[model samples]
Target: MNLKEIKLAPFIKLIFIIAIIAYVVLNTDIMGFVSKGISPVLTAFIIAYILDYVVRFFELKMKVPRSLSILISILLFLLILTTIGLFIVPRVVGAVSSLIKAIGNFEFDINALSQLDFDNFYLNEIQQAIVDTVTPLIQKLTNATGTAVLIVVNEVQKITSGLISLVISFAISIYMLGEKRDLLARIKRTLFAYLSDQTANQVLYASRMANKIFKAFFLGKLLDSTIIGVLAYLVFTIFNFEYALLIALIIGLTNMIPYFGPFIGAVPAAVITLIANPSSPIDVVWILICILAIQQLDSLVIGPFILGDSVGVSAFWIIVAVTVGGATFGIVGMFMGVPVLVLLKTLIEEDVEKRLAFQGYEGFQSNDIKNKKSRK
Candidate 1:
């Protein structure tokens, strides 16, 4: 049968077959030759790669050359890195160290708490047992936390696999950016050469969807976190909450975890404040309430203003992504899980819409719909 005569289902099966073949090749020997050491160089270049589009934007539209644009990109990249290194890093390190010190003094903090009596407090036998079990652990938390962090750092050093993987990832991203266009065009031609034009376009469209998801996710995350952090710091400092800078920073960063990050970040911050001032439990509680209010504002108010309806992944998918990421990569996995879901969701949506329109559905111009509406 002629290529166009082949049934769509069989064609899809063939594409999956090709994808499996490609995956195996990438998994086996083909990927082995593409990477080496100097991961930091690769890291810088990945930073450069993201900025390259901006560079190219200025170059083509603003009447500049590639070299000058690249230079501008490089300078901006370094300035950003330097700014973070000099300004942000110190504060981060100090906050971490302070938290550790507080942990080291945990027993003292809790013991101080136990020196009080509660009026009209009622507890069942089960409640009393639970409290007894938890109290000692809470007492030991300060030491345990510092010790746990030390153990983790040691394990990271012991594991030779992580460092190697990190290096390879950076190297791949670097080379990919440097030769992106030539490689992209070659891949496009190769995919289109064998496959139907429609199938090739689907692959291209999926890739674009994935890229858009990544951009929306990462940029949105950075923006949301920054605003929350700045607001938290300003509010906390005004109220003179203990560990304001540290707690605000932590809350701001972790707030991006969605639904759960705020709680995770806030609990620790509140605990630290409680440890620092067990006498002022009421004050600590009030501060926590304030922090929660800030989070609510961020989620409902500022968040919508910035992010809009960009990522349309639902709540159920979010839970699934978090579960999978935490299962595989622990905290880091959990942190990135939602973004993965967002990308996958976008890709799925694009594919489904394409298939619907392929057989001819009215008003199914998914790509141009947004542009047209905006123009109108």
Candidate 2:
């Protein structure tokens, strides 16, 4: 074989031995705990990042203790989350419920409309199509309403579970943040003890970049969704639509989808509008125009400004990431899929631009050109 493999038989044996041991460790019951515990670990990581910034600001700028600084940061983060949740979630829930309740009436109302033989057959067809499209949507909304009732009934237990996890995560984050310097010292010590400083630095740097990417992506998109939801609610109220709150909330929440988010959000919103006012042609047109206009504002301005700043992905690449994500994983997958791609893109770009730059590829471009000429 290869000269290097032939010469490094002992090293290869050691690697195999290590790999087998590690594999066993990672596949055992202990690994199940690790897998299940990933959520808290990540939760802690987010908390730590936010706390780290706050601690640095206070400790460096105000000459305060790390403990107080971390507490203040955690409180601030909690406050922000609570304020947004209070303002948005209830209104959204109410709107969704009202929309669900109104759908049955709207459907029955449409059946009555068929009695009139409205001047044009086209109008009749349009009304029938609208009813057909909305029927399934109404069913889905009803199902969601049932699920919401279940949640409300089990709210205590759910809240308890949520609180417990949140507490554990916060504690872990506090530990990490408070002892960040010491933790770094231990990591550096381990790396120097077992490996080289240069490799360790590279690993650490890559990890920081990955962490930053996740932080910016999740938080920035959350902000974007909140803005859109609130704006839609306001607009809907202004229009004096009966289910303004509900449809707007749905649009906002669903707006979290990447490239196709707007269309997904608009469907139910438009359907709700059309069904609710099938006779009022002008109202239906206006609702369509308004939903499209809001989506346009998001795609053109708000989305680009917020998500674009954090993810730093171009519109073209956003479409690519979203399309691949949707094709692979459906809706929920699409939500997380783009961020995963961005992380991978970041790593590949970094690796190529950094460590792999010196790897030889001298004739690759010219060889391709020569091959094309020969084929011609």
Q: Each model's TM-score?
A: 0.70, 0.67
Please give the lDDT score for candidate 1.
0.70
Query: What is candidate 1's lDDT per residue for 1-376, written digit by digit as tens?
Result: 2324324565467646865764564466654554334444556455655776667777899988766776676677668778976987778767767766767665433344444455435634545555677687676774587676787578658668765664565455555555667888999999999999998998898788767776677677778998999899899889888778788888987887767788888888877787666667777787788888998998789987777766565567778888776665567677778877776555555555666656565355556543311331
lDDT of each: 0.70, 0.71
Best by lDDT: 2
Per-residue lDDT of 215-296 in model 2, one digit per residue for the tens? 6777677788889887987887898876787777778778887768878877777777865665664676677688788888
Off by more than 4 A, model 1: 1-49, 56-66, 108-130, 145-180, 193-198, 349-376
Question: How many residue pairs in model 1 have overlapping backbones?
Answer: 1
Q: Candidate 2, after superposition: displacement of residue 83 in Å?
A: 3.2
Distance from true position, residue 296, model 1, in Å? 1.4
Clashing residue pairs in all predictions, respectively, total: 1, 1
At residue 40, candidate 2 shows an lDDT of 86
